[model samples]
Target chain A: MALLDYFLRSKEKQVTTASKAKERLQIIVAHERNQRNKQPDYLPQLTEDLLAVLRKYIPVTENSLSVNVDKKDGDLNVLELNIELQEENSGK
Target chain B: MALLDYFLRSKEKQVTTASKAKERLQIIVAHERNQRNKQPDYLPQLTEDLLAVLRKYIPVTENSLSVNVDKKDGDLNVLELNIELQEENSGK
Candidate 1:
């Protein structure tokens, strides 16, 4: 029973860690999206502010954005931004 | 003539750099999206392989992924992945 309990606990820990990593990735992605939509001249300043806000809550790993522009009927362009998070691997 | 030539060369250099940066960013974003769609268990191995491929060509900055799941009519889940590239700043 003790061995079984130990195995169960380890599995639970792994699950928890994976979920936590996913959550962190979500936040970083959001930040990256915001940065990409920003004007090129303003990106650096905005990125710094975002990093500060994120650091206040949880420790973030890495944040970045990928932006795509979709053209409409006219000359207007719609931007789609993707944000991503990098999680540190902690092997058990 | 000398002053005009110098001005034109500087502007040309700036345009070249901006274009190059944008191209690099696009490649990174594509890679990130690919990674996010991959299964969790295979992510590490996939990431390493991708990095190796990217490194052989031009120098890449930083790459990451963010994934979102959207539910369709019934039980179909569509995954949206965002990939991003981090460019190092070199103010000239």
Candidate 2:
């Protein structure tokens, strides 16, 4: 969903931190059930390339978003991104 | 830090999922102390644009990375992305 709809829909509602964290995580993790292994150099490049493109659309500085891969077991690996977005008013 | 460094350093340690989640979050949240208000339409564009660029570097399809913005106490807001990465072996 777009940010404008989010603000317009929830402008009166108060979302809790714990709720926010999990809900956001569910959205991100929901799609990540697929698994793959990556070369060591790829993730950083991915993050950089992603930011370069995201910057064209949003105000993403160096620390605004982070992507990484972590192993679940010896065989299972996860790719995760933690992003900090601009406030709704500033996004314009 | 680069992915190579993460692998070389973490090659031995057994990082748990609970631990993994927090560690990843710490990396994502560590830098978000700065605050800003954003327009609502910015987030989906950011996620989409980021993925478009990331796909150029890695094998990211539709269900790979997820980004969202949530609120706390109405004023404190968060931008979060949960990304699933390729396996290290598959990356090469």
Candidate 3:
């Protein structure tokens, strides 16, 4: 019985921290949604064009490419492109 | 001289297409910068906190994690989190 309680206590501690993190993320994510609604409509078009160009040189799927715009300063913004490269002929 | 011209023509074709893509990206990216300026200030903080949470469960580096908020519908927004996982004990 003591062993069961010990394991349960440890499991609860882990859950507590993880759930706290999730709650925090939910709040921040909600705020982010408000800001994102104001973004320009050109983002989707840009993503599609960039993906088409990248596909010409790299073997990438829709899941592997993401484009984002991050605010740097008052007037500066950074266009971030992420592409996950897969090994060619991976023998896995 | 004929062989040289053939190689030059092929190289020029490749360069022209790549350069055209680059120029298009540049123009769209410039427009994106303007829209990104209105994004909320909590993005960096949200990214850091999410990274910290992820580190507790996954072996990820700064370069492997990115968080972005993407607009979905008129009132909905999607918070995208990307983490590039590395193999454990890679026998390379």
Candidate 4:
């Protein structure tokens, strides 16, 4: 009975450790994402490339456009390009 | 010289394996995200909850709103709520 009790306690301890590790990983990932948002080296070059492509279709200035790489769950990177279209630019 | 060459080859093999593992992980994650997008169980309930909260302030129907959980890189889940406000709802 004591051996069984010891095994059960050991299993419970392992589960706790696994969950704690997951929580710690989540915190670290979130912190890293925040830091990346603050200053990503590739953003400007990427934005410039995107803007050049977009200019062929739409008349957009640098001020009217914004771009960022958003980190998602499950190791997905989303490149979000936001363009504010002026009234004149629309309905064409 | 033979031993040093063997060590260098092993190191190169390890690097290749690590990069291959990363590529495989990326493909699996992309597939999982595609599958999740097709049928996510929580989206409707979350949308309903958001609509309920929004209705307290703005007069909106179910047709004018949308909600989805967008998975980002680095284990981030972004809940995007998009509401298409009519002309009457605007400039208030």
The estimated TM-scores of all candidates read 0.21, 0.35, 0.24, 0.24
Off by over 4 Å in 2: A1-40, A57-92, B1-14, B17-41, B62-69, B73-76, B85-92
Residue pairs in collision within model 3: none
The list of candidate 4 runs beyond 4 A from truth reads A1-44, A72-76, A89-92, B1-92
Model 3 misplaced regions, further than 4 Å: A1-44, A88-92, B1-92
Winner on DockQ (1 vs 2): 2
DockQ, candidate 2, vs. native dimer: 0.12
Would you give me the overall lDDT of model 1?
0.33
The digit string of per-residue lDDT tens for model 4 on B25-90 reads 000001012222233334335345534544543345576554444443422233444344333333
Name the candidate, 1 or 4, with the larger TM-score value.
Answer: 4
Question: Would you list the clashing residue pairs of candidate 4?
Answer: A71-B72, A71-B73, A72-B71, A72-B72, A72-B73, A73-B72, A73-B76, A76-B73
**Over all chains combined, what TM-score does candidate 1 have?**
0.21
The prediction achieving the highest lDDT against the true structure is 2
Sliding window of 10 residues with minimal summed lDDT for model 1 chain B: B23-32
Best by DockQ: 2
- Model 2, B3-23: lDDT tens digits are 324432342353332223211
lDDT of 3 by residue, B1-92 (tens): 22223323433454345322111111101011112134443434534554554454444556655544543222223344544433233376
Order of candidates by TM-score, top first?
Answer: 2, 3, 4, 1
* TM-score head-to-head 1 vs 3, winner: 3
Q: Model 1, stretches more than 4 Å misplaced?
A: A1-22, A25-40, A62-92, B1-92
Fnat of candidates, each listed: 0.00, 0.16, 0.00, 0.00
Best by TM-score: 2
